[model samples]
Target: MSNPTVTAAQANKTPVLVAICLAAIILPLSFVSGSIATPVISRELGGSAQALSWITNAFMLSFGCFLMAAGALADEIGRKKVFIIGVSLFALFSGLIGFSSSLIWIDLMRAAQGVAAAAALAGGSASLAQEFEGRAQMRAFSMLGTSFGVGLAFGPFLAGLLIAHFGWRAVFLSSMVIALLSLSVAVTRLNESKNPNAAGIDWPGTVLFTAMLALLTWGLMEIPSKGTTSVEVLGLLGATVVLLILFVAVERKVRHPMLDLSLFRYARFIGVQALPLSTAFAFVVLLVLLPMQFIGITGMNEEQAGLMMMALSLPMLIIPMFAALLTHWISAGLVCTLGLVISAIGLGWLSQAIASQDMFAALAPMALIGIGIGLPWGLMDGLSISVVPKERAGMATGIFSTTRVAGEGIALAIVGAMLAGFVGQGIQQLSLAKDSHTASLAVQRLATGDLHQALLELPSTNALQLTAIYASAFQHLLLWLAAITLISAAIVFAALCLKTVPTEVSETLCEPDQ
Candidate 1:
């Protein structure tokens, strides 16, 4: 009576390749668009740089804050339903953003987009995890990484082309198109995957946690644009600190915490979680800081600088193909640690090349940084989800995304502060140079471009002297970044030693719940 051919494979639903493509379309657009679209939008509306910044920051803050709650919701309500809701909300707000005339409207819509993105993003990884297992799971994770990288790599360049051809409105409109298409596919193709036994949404904890993240992120964003000493800025920072404490207290008392405070009990979970956080921090800081250095100090034009910046994404695109293959034999921890070490080396090498203005020479080190970023980041989702219960994959994925965005925001604040400090030092050194009068003139001219401005400002009689001063000061920034990269390497290495690789534990952890 039994059908011999009815293996799990025969019963399994055919994987929807379109879903991955749909996910790829929406995954990193919000991030790339949020950061990349601001300047054009601000200029068109005659808004301050600060207003442009808030447009991006508002989205990041809300997106990061709600991720955990979205994950919890996905688990309770079903990923298919939650994803549809997120997509619909995302499309509606994205349309609002495209036509908005006011800066306030743009910021609010961006925030709404963030909320929708949080839900969609949280479920994306979980959907893949639930749909596939064993070799299939590995393939799904690898493909998921590729999808994410494609979104990230393409987002800015795509936005640039659209903005140039169609204007800033095109960027938001594109998101809407992708969101609607994805939503349609998901509704028709994806099945419900809700765990009835999973804990319900933790409203109190979610509110407190989101409040804490928002306060902290807002305060961090202020440090760059508004000096740290400003009364209002300091007040925000103080509020963030207090809210964080309260958030922790609330989580401990909550029956179902949005963030499971007890997850830290697993040393492995802590390490896996920390890897994504640090990797995101390092990558974001480098992305923000490096392009300015190339444009300001190395004298690349905007387009040239943007192209050079592609070196970061290049390795990300290629390394994962090899990385996915390696994962079958290599422990995820080893691969991730190797990635971190390689990135540190690349950044360290980049530090040494600061004395040279050649962009070609800079490429090698930067390409290495890209390789480093791709390897670990690619493995992170798999490693994190593999450790948690299958029923809780949505929640875990949500926390992973939250940490990632939070790290990104934190990196922006930290690196922005460091860059300001470096520039200030460069100015001071230029001012204090022996040929002070001529150097001051050149420093003023630095608004044009680093190399040419320095060349122009230095007296023909003292050209060499001034050039040396500029190079010396610029190298200091390089040295500082190099040091930070090494420090990051050490942190990663320590985390690796403290945690076991997932392959060793995957079987035990992946055992289906009774």
Candidate 2:
């Protein structure tokens, strides 16, 4: 006979689970919509290209950097409390950003929004770990992933509709409603959790790590304009390295490290880390880049560009579930590796299709990329902590979330710099403008799809020539992305399936419980 107490406990978890899922939906929806809203925001606010970039960068940077700190704080104090606080602040900041007239105010609020996101994701996911166990836990986390998938799948189209009718501010403001809902649900339904013996956080390490990331990102952002070899860029990069070494030293010595550095010792854990970073470079970067390509370069309107992006994100809704089911039949590592391979193939196909200058032709490859990425994307949250012991799951979840979001932010910046650099080189080679300064201006304008302004700056070039060069640069970038994805697939497969590993490790890594 079933005990009433046990049945009651199980029933109570449902509302808490729903709240966590809602929180999951809020951030990813914000991420995609913010990208979709960027150009429109730029048009209205009239900021310089450098300042305009903060719309995405500021949020990602703060969100990425503070994840570990937030997770640690959650463990020490209370998970549900931190989560509620984070969601509430995110809603407030979204409203502030939406209403602000100045770029500086908007950017500051965006950064604050990111910190809140970090707290919510880290606290909420960790709380999820506490609420469920074993295979049930995996399914619950899968629901979490699906929530993220839902946001990615529908965010663009929704943002487009909102932009078309209510204006771009809706993109930011829309997230407020979601956040408030998630917050209210969490406040009421979720039970607070904490670690009894958890030590204090390593504030010094946290500060250094955040600073290192900020410096590295700033250096990358400067690369397109200042050139990689510029004194300022070099100094920032150097400082970044120094800070990283110091952060490592502090983490090694700290009584309570933000990330348990030794977690990297497990081959499977290392492989799991690669999964998020791979998806970041291969999938997340494209989320930002593809929409810009569709809207800026090809002159598609918001709705049209959002529709084009559907081919890229729509598969996410279904493919991740398919991937989860397939793991029961085959090694999870193999499935993820295969997904990366498919995505690499899609990237190559995309590059080739770009040569045709046909948007519709590119759709199939975009879908292919989405389908491929969905496999790995679905499994990441589960795999992140499965390799580690339950006792360490909070730190594991924190580190994994940090890697995924931070990697996305860093990859986006790097790819942006590379694309701009490629366009700059193409401009000089094509002699689009004789003056170096004029060519630089044209490169900046072209990168943002301000082709009209670019042509005005480079009077010598016609529309056809600039378009061809842009296409060529884009093609090369896609190929590079494809190559990186392929290499990561091999590494992840090798690490996860290593025969030298212990039997228990191998079973967990390759044959996750379905």
Candidate 3:
């Protein structure tokens, strides 16, 4: 016999789920869409390379720094209130970004948009956890994952279409429209949810965490251009270390910590948390690097490159639905481990194929990577939230989300350094055969990632040889990326191997002090 109370709750869940999914879609959409439009923005505004990088870095820095505090606030105040505020602010800032006359204004607005995203993401995930439980919780998280995948998969395609027809501003304008629509749905359908007995915010812990993230991210962003040994880079790294130590000390003493330190005791939780970092390092970094390869190595236009990426993105959209089903038969931990292994294999294959310089040969590896990445996409959020209490959903999701953003930033910096090092070495070797000035100029064009420009600057006879040199350097970089990804998989697998004492989700959600 069906219970009327259970039936009523199920019926109300649908609208709330829709609103949460929309919120999930909006944040990633804003991120990837901006990435696609960045070149056009730089061209139109006449911004320097350093200033242009800030357009994206500013958003990432603030977004990552604010996530922990925002999540705690959602648990303390109300998810509905935070979600609505985030959506509204996101819309306002996104629209303002489109109207900016200078690069500085755009960077400032993008930073504001990041803060708004942290709020919406934390609040939305917590709300969904509060509204559903058990199998229903798994389904809700799967749908949320699907929405996130869709945003990332189609973001480039949509941005290319809009920028080609309506100009780059249209990309931000479109985001504004989506945010507004999500805001309206949220206001109408979402219910206020928070921990009734939640303690006050841990201001000291929050400040220390935010400062540590900001300094760390700023230093990472600067490393590619300034090199690792620069005074500014060393200073930021030193400051970040001090803040991280301070943050740990404060969290231990705080009555209500921004991040509960005891959560790390569970090996299962640690394994689940590592998924975002692995995915970001392996997949998100590729998303940034591959477009450059397509344009610089293959001489593909922006539209063509965006379309080609569909080979990678399409599988991510399709595979997650099956991941849920697979987990029913296979343990979620084993499923995640398999996904990581497959991703490493795919990346390894791609490194070999980069030397071939055949577009068709690249597609198969790209598709394999997409499938491998997608398998874990559906499982990560569900598993992370399941281990913790519903009340702590915001904190868990905040930490998960932070790893992703920070991982991407760190991966880019690491890969950038490798690429620069290898390419410089390749150019130096090539200069022994040709005039040093011409070789250096050709390599400089290659570094810009503009194939057409490199081709135009070099003699036809030399173009093919110079391209081969660049391609060889790129292949080496891919090998390093693949190695790092494989290492991450091994770490996750080892973590999951540890024996863990099972506890009820409800029991886990109780106050840390209790």
Which candidate has the highest lDDT of all? Answer: 2
lDDT of 1 by residue, 329-367 (tens): 666666777787787777667766656655678778878
Deviation in Å, model 3, residue 46 alpha carbon: 3.2
Give candidates' CA RMSD values in order.
Answer: 5.8, 1.7, 4.6
Candidate 2 lDDT, tens digit per residue, 110-149?
8999999999988898799799877667778888989999
Which whole-number lDDT from 0 to 100 does residue 364 have in model 3?
Answer: 89
Write the residue-wise lDDT of candidate 3 on 1-514 in tens digits: 9889988988887888887788788777777776666666755785544565666667777877787778778878998998888888989998999888888899899989999998988888878878899878878887888898888888777877887788889889888888888887888888898888778788998888878877887786665456678899899999999999989998898787878878787666677778888887678767767766775567665667777777878787888887777865666666677787888888888877888777778888888888988888877776676666666655676677777765666666556556756765776765532564554444545653544455555654456776676778778887776777788777766665444535645322111212
> In model 3, where do residues sit more than 4 Å from their true spots?
1-9, 387-395, 431-466, 498-514
Rank the candidate models, highest lDDT first.
Answer: 2, 3, 1
Question: What C-alpha lDDT does candidate 3 achieve relative to the native structure?
Answer: 0.75
The TM-score leader among the candidates is 2
Q: Tell me the spans in candidate 1 whose CA falls farther than 4 Å from its real position.
A: 1-17, 288-306, 327-330, 352-357, 386-396, 427-481, 498-514
Which is better, 2 or 3, measured by TM-score?
A: 2
Rank order by TM-score, top first?
2, 3, 1
Q: How many backbone clashes does candidate 1 have?
A: 0
